[model samples]
Target: IYTGVYADGVNQANRRKSRHEQSFVAPEWGWAWPMNRRILYNRASADPEGRPWSERKAYVWWDADAQQWTGEDVPDFEKTKPPSYRAPAGADGVEAIEGIDPFIMQGDGKGALYAPQGLVDGPMPTHYEPVESPFRNQLYGQQANPTRVEYRRDDNPMNPAPPEEHVDVFPFVFTTSRLTEHHTAGGMSRYLEHLAELQPEMFVEVSPALAAERGLEHMGWCHVVTARSVVEGRVLVTERLRPLKVEGRTVHQVWMPYHWGSGGLVKGDSANDLFGITLDPNVLIQESKVGTCDVQPGRRPTGAAMRQYVEEYTSRAGVTDAEYPPIVTVSDDIVTASEDTGTQEEEDDE
Candidate 1:
């Protein structure tokens, strides 16, 4: 494993573990599979036909004097082979690869702009409205990933899908992400007292409009609810979160940081726990980054009362996958049209 190997919580067997799947290796080196190497697709630096793209970032280049292929990075081709040599279509090894095949990791060695295989869902990335989405799906008919995982345990209850039509009682969407000041999940940052003091308590940042609507004063206690969980934090009313205008509908967003899990020194309720196990199919990454939730003023119930609050929220906002979220559209046609015109003008000058 290279750098950035993180202990991403427990496994299915409840064992504490870590993963570093990004490492790659060179052929003839000591290591093998079951352990990924550092340079799995080093061949991609070259163009399709085994020609180097640029002399500077070149992994391999032809040496006219030596009449052989040479490179600074590991050579994706046979060491002594010349660029002019061609292997037949059915031939194995490097010869069978077309000049356009850049990513050598796959058997075919081609760069797939649109992946035909390997991904669980369709290969290309498509935006889906979150399971607890406030807006309509904009990408054709596809809503969220149909295969989104739902953990049936009592600890994780999901919201009902549309058509069944759940109530939008706590009518706001919230996203929990990392702040630059803290590391991913806050396990490391909570260990330090100075860092803990700076962000002393778990806080939920809300827009001033939402705060006023809910009768929440600045720095007051606020309760955020989702289908799965209810988390309480100090309110931080800010203007940074304005209502976004999308497709003639107003969409408001709340930003929360998911740093305070259990076992940390300055720990509080985990923001990640509020999200059900909905994930993006292509990368198998949790869609904990975005979800739907409702916020209200005042402190959350403690002990048994807290559990009731979560159950009540789940009963109201039944879970289901729905449409894709709206996106801002930008046209690249003008840029493409200018490219051909600029090339013709340059050629005329010559």
Candidate 2:
């Protein structure tokens, strides 16, 4: 009851003895996951010679003379087996497990640093920009994740091109999260009056600085857009959501809870409608949890006007169909975009 690790009370082998020796005396041994193993890799508690590291920190140890396992808990190692014991060549099953090695599940009975196989992409990880990003890769020439499973269906469209080639129209960084009062997608929590009352409606959290620039009113209606879709929610101007000064530019961000959906009792637009299908390479999990978007004050355009709204932004921002950045690096100096523009204009005038 004290520790949530075990279903029942710990071992009560001896009233005067420590808790370690009482593991078996419980109403039942660990009834939790991983076969009730109180502690994983218990064999490591003992040295390679099968003796405890210190008298005070003694745990699982192999009793050589008695030829048995003795400890405060069940030993994760083979009973009566000494650390000197090594499996013979061509040994199978448990016989193949070396007495000195604690991690038996591994192929070599050791931890892996570089994976030899099983990974679809390269074994090592590299930095790649997301499917939608306002900046290019600062370290390498790789603009976006080459291995990501990108999709462009009729239902699921894409956003702007790589940062170096095309200027992104969706300037602000947008992401989705869940509120404490509501459950995921508002399936169970929205129907409950108690939970629904806390968060009465869907809203977007914006920095007070961004709110001033966009002229958004507190608790006023605001629309967010992407190449895929547009969604509207109430504006929540808060100081907590502040702008980030990245590369000498004040980059604003939009945050919204994804709990609301059309099916809920408090029906509202789903934040998921903003982006199309883009998935992690190994797991194939969609990046719907977060993506980039554009925000505007007032309600979203309807019918034919919506298409025109998107097309106009695309034309203004020059959304090219370039898959990757043409030039690897933008400039030699570590200057801001504002300074770079100033220098370019001076050169043009000269």
Candidate 3:
């Protein structure tokens, strides 16, 4: 019912066209979702009376002569439904929707600045610090999102955050992304000669200031250390990775492409190894895109030494085996409680 192209013949016809000068929507070129409607809520392109807001920008509008909605693309609304048509009192389902209502999914069929439901965090958007960061949240008393998901396991150790001591141990910020030359995890692209040639080895990009501070030389080998694992990459001292001034402190950021891995022909340390598995509470997506780590010049230790190297940093940073950082950190009471618990544990050990 959504895409009207039903058979192989219809699908072929939709895909045959190369270009159309008349309309950019190209309804005939290829099918779109929701009964082949190209633009969702295209009804909003016109005024309440179903007239185009501007002739040049004309999209879907009501055809008074045909007494139905007509447009370059399929009408999102019931085709026969006129603009003036209003639902009577106590109407149910689609019948309850008014003629002026463009957002059919919403209860009131209107855009909402604040959602009434269907959100785990809250209605309005609020800024919360990342699960791991070098700085404390400056705006609110809360350091990070209280509703964020945390995997409190031995393997997925978390770096220290604000209100916790030794956050400076992992002082630099690192983020991971993709490079166009290689596909995700380099599964297909890495084996191919051409693609592998484009990005021969994994590399980390750092700002000039960070390079100077860390004594990193361009094209030299360096390793990024986190509580989880250490991954080394060839140093690329570039201005693309900028140093930002936050809270009157110059903060440096490191960036790497998460394409290369051990299995790939163009093998290098995987940037993903540097991240811990923290997730958004709502969607459960791993928040591994950004985190904090320490950058050191040279390759990371291998085998048993790698484990010890990571543990050394965690120990120095005071990262405990206690449950992931307390969810609600806005109150001093919670911090005090956590400290008290830590003190009691130390006493018990004594």
Candidate 4:
């Protein structure tokens, strides 16, 4: 599919002339997939009769004189196909698709408001709280995504969520993201002295208000504690990490870069250590982006003390064993088996 679409010896001129706003599509510069068509389903930019929807926003349209589709970008439909062409009776495959249908790949050649297939959850979009969120789901009685996968193990203990007691043990929201200076987990970039010097050590970003509330000093050592593990980092008190008011309650968030590890040239505790194993049911992607953690002002304990420290918090939160949070919560009541069983109770018609 990428035959003539890549920048190479023969296609050097097109790649060199690539510029922004150059004829909008810049078909001559660079390349795109599926026969170098810059836009997908560009036929939608025109009307059923193949006239441009608007002159200012014209993209791909039919050339009436030549009786073929032509414009700034290549037409997504068959090149010689005409606007008035209709699929004959008993037609199948490409021949079955109407000329006016921009989304030819779909069964009915139309965009779906609610997907009928290709999803593990329901067909329609629905909101669910994060697996380890501090607050309850305000919009729905169902607290979190019931379809989410959980690993109920002694090592991967979950933090207490809404309707669970001792949620305050790990009150603050903790999140991890990539830093521009280093590549993912700093495997290659940390080995390079230049890149390592750019972001030498791992640091957590917090708002000034949170620092004051937690007795944390700017640029001082601080540790984030989760039921899973404890990770320490230098503190960076900045206004960029603001506290949000969710449900009229102040919610402080701690942000960290997950590019540091023990093997790297610039070593530090991994920010990912603070997350438990909760996954999206469809793709099975680990939900490590956000969770709950408690922030402390000093470096975390070492060796056996570290294990004891985590145990103390978990014991208080009532999740020290293999028992995980309930999968389904309706009106702050468990309506499903514990996360280990992954079983949900059928709803009762009230």
TM-score of each: 0.64, 0.66, 0.77, 0.79
lDDT values of the candidates?
0.65, 0.73, 0.84, 0.85
Which pairs clash (backbone N, Cα, C closer than 3 Å) in model 4?
Answer: none
The residue pairs that clash in candidate 3, if any, are: 2-35
lDDT of 1 by residue, 240-279 (tens): 9997887786667787888887765677777886777766
Provide the lowest-lDDT 10-residue window in model 3.
7-16
Kindly list the per-residue Cα lDDT of model 4 for residues 36-83, writing each as its tens digit.
777788899999999999999999898989989998887888888998
Give the clashing residue pairs of candidate 2, or none. Answer: 11-22
Question: How would you encode candidate 2's per-residue C-alpha lDDT over 1-350 as one tens digit per residue?
Answer: 33444334543322244446554434243243444456767888888888898868787898888887777666777777778888899987778778887766665454455667656666776676666777767766566666677664555555664544444577888888889999888989989988888887889899999899999999999999876678899999998888998777888989999888876568788888776777877789985555667788998888899878876765555553443223233344533665889999999999
Poorest 10 consecutive residues by lDDT, candidate 2: 320-329
If the candidates were sorted by their lDDT against the true structure, best first, what order would they fall in?
4, 3, 2, 1
Q: How does residue 183 of candidate 4 score in lDDT?
A: 92
Candidate number that wins on lDDT, 1 or 4: 4
- On lDDT, the stronger of 1 and 3 is 3
Which candidate leads in lDDT? 4
**Span of 10 residues, lowest total lDDT, candidate 4:** 341-350
Error of 4 at 171 (Å): 1.4
